[model samples]
Target: MDWQTTKKDFKRYLEFERNLSGNSVHAYLNDVRKLEVYCEDLNLEIEKLTAQHIQHFLLWINEFALSPFTQARLLSGLKTFFNFLQIEYDLTANPCELIETPRLTRKMPSVLNIEEIDSLINAIDLSKPEGMRNKAIIEVLYGCGLRVSELINLKISNLFLDVEFIKVEGKGNKERLIPVGQQAIKYLKIYMDDIRVHQSIKSGKEDFVFLNRRGSPLSRVMVFIIVKDLAQKIGLQKEISPHTFRHSFASHLVEGGADLRAVQDMLGHESITTTEIYTHIDKDYLQSVITQFHPRS
Candidate 1:
């Protein structure tokens, strides 16, 4: 079958069968398209592709200096695509079956210390009309360890502020309740009651907790830009984004002796392995723990 036809089928399978999010489906398609381009230059047919052609494509992409993590993801996407073909078309063999994924080095996520977090939040210009809204955004992001998408899509109906908890829809449309700190709840109330109540909210957007000046919910890009601007305003050297607040929240919780399972549930991580990255504590803290808690020390 042709590349376009096969890709259309793959998209359907991803959306309906696998139930992947739109962003995930887009990423997988983009990965396949890269290989499709490579094959097109060589006059290779999608159905007739062999393991050797896949290996050559990997080598060619390596010349572009793609990171191992990206390379591994590309290979994974291809493997999934070929597996789908095998099931649908009854292909005798899967070309990606024997292929080896590139070994990836796990990089530690960047985290902000409490002081840095305070500085970044304090740098917000409270004189501006959106100042309390921005402050509440940061507080929710850090205090609740919410993803940017979750923070943007947060709804008024989901907030249980009376009991200090919030229900956020996470990846795969799963919902989780995260405990909100008093500080976050305080700013959220100020934003909702004082600032947001006075604004003319757009129809169908009144339920959203955070909104732009135009009465629309904030976009993910806007959240990233806000975080970037705040970082620059505070002269923070660490390259960070909205996700950095999440990392800081998890790191601080781990450092403060919070249970890993509790952190995992709060962060809405699917696996404990995904949440284990926060266990990489600094050596100074490790030494202090041993000195204080170990009998031999």
Candidate 2:
């Protein structure tokens, strides 16, 4: 089959059957496209490609000096594509079955200390209409440990502020209730009661907890720009993003002796192993845990 039709089929498979996000589906398709390009340049039909062709494509891409993490991601996508071909198209043999992902050196994400977080928040221009909104955004981002997409899509109906919990819609549209802190609750209330209520919300946008000046839902890029602008304003240059608050939240909670499972639940991580990074980030906390709970101690 031609790569074009195969790609369309793969897209549908990922969207409907696998239930991946749009960004995730595009990423997997992009990886497949790289292999398609290599095959096209050498005039090799994709259906006839074997493991050697796949290997050759990997080697060719390696010339671009991609990071190890990126290399691993690309390999993962290729493996998924061939598996889809085998299952859906009934291919006799999967080409990328035996390929190994490149070993990646995991780097610890940068965490914002409480003081740095306070400084960033305090620097907001409260005189402006969006100032309280920005404060509330930072509070929820750090307090709830939410992803940017979740923050942007946060609905008023899903919020249980009086009960101190907010239902977050995470990856794959999975919903989880995260406990909100008192500070987040206070600022979120102010933004909603005072600021957002005054806005001329457009039709169908009223339920969104956060809205722009035009009364529409905020975009992910707008959130990034907001965080970046705040970072620049405070002169804190640690390469922060909306996710830095998430990492900071987990790290601080781990340091404060919160249960790992509880933190994982709050962050909506599917695997406990994904939440294990907090243990590494807080070395003293790790030591304390060992000392307090370990049989060897």
Best by lDDT: 1
Q: Over the stretch 80-115, how does candidate 2's per-residue lDDT look in tens digits?
A: 888898888888788888878888766888999999
Against the reference, the lDDT scores of all candidates come to: 0.93, 0.92
Candidate 2 segments whose C-alpha is farther than 4 A from its true place: 284-297
Error of 1 at 283 (Å): 5.6
Per-residue lDDT of 6 in model 2: 92
Which residue pairs clash in candidate 1? Answer: none
How far out, in Å, is residue 276 in model 1?
1.2
Question: For this target, which candidate reaches the highest TM-score against the unseen true structure?
Answer: 2
**lDDT tens digits, residues 219-279, model 1?**
9999999999999998899999999999989989999889999999999998999888889
RMSD of 2: 3.7
Measured against the true structure, the TM-scores of the candidates, in listed sequence, are 0.91, 0.92
Which pairs clash in the backbone of model 2? none
Model 1 regions lying over 4 Å from their true place = 282-297
